[model samples]
Target: LAALLAPGNFIVMGAALLLNGFAVAPTLTAGLAAAERSVVEKRKTEVLAWAISALNLGGALPPAITGYIIDTQGVSVAFVIPLVCMSLSVVMILPYLNIWREKVREIPA
Candidate 1:
C-alpha cells in the first residue's frame, strides 16, 4: 500500500486513504479489548491504563514524525512510517501471543 502512492496520483492516494481508514478504524477498540483480555483480573485496570496512554501517545506522536518525514524525504517515503510502525508493533506483541491466545480462549461464549 505504501508503495502505491506517487507524487501526483489522486486515485492512488484516495484509495490508500480509504483503505487506511478501514484498517485503522478497528485498531483502538481491538487493541484495548486484547489488552484487557491478556492481563490478569487484578492488573486489568493498570494494564488498561497503560494501554490507553500508549494509544494516546501513538495517536499524537505519528503525525509530527510523518510530517517531518514528508518535509525531508517526500510523501511517498513518509507513507512507509505506518507500515514500519505496524510491523514493529506486531513484533513487539509476538512474545505475548500465547498468553493472549490462552486468555481469549478462556472467555465463555
Candidate 2:
C-alpha cells in the first residue's frame, strides 16, 4: 500500500486495494471461523469478543506503526514493516496450526 501509494497512482492503488480486499476477506473470515470452532459453549461469547478485539487491534495498530515508519523512512521502506510482521506472524502460527490439525483429527470427523 505505502509503496503503491507513494507513486501517487490512484488507479494502481485502487486496483491493489480491491485485490487486497478480496485476498483478505477469506483470511479474516477463516480466522473468525477458527475462533468459533475452538471456543467452548460456556465461554463462546467471551472468546469471540477476545477474538474480535484482537482482530480490531491487529488491524488498527499496524497502520499507526507503518505510518510512523513512513514518516521516518520512505514509503517503500515502510512497507517492510508489514511484510516483516506478516512473516513473523506466519512463523508464530505454524506451530499452532499443527496443533489445531492434530486436535481436529482426534475429534474423529
lDDT of each: 0.82, 0.78
Model 2 is weakest, by summed lDDT over 10 consecutive residues, at 100-109
Q: Judge candidate 2 against the unseen true structure and give its global Cα lDDT, from 0 to 1.
A: 0.78
- Span of 10 residues, lowest total lDDT, candidate 1: 1-10
TM-score of each: 0.71, 0.79
Candidate 2 regions off by >4 Å? 1-6, 106-109
Write one digit per residue (lDDT tens) for candidate 1, span 14-71: 8878897998769777878877877679999999999889879988999998998899
How badly does each model clash, as a count of residue pairs?
Answer: 0, 0
Per-residue lDDT tens digits for candidate 2, residues 2-108, read 34555877778788888888988798887777666675679778878998899899889988988888888887687577679979989999989987876566543
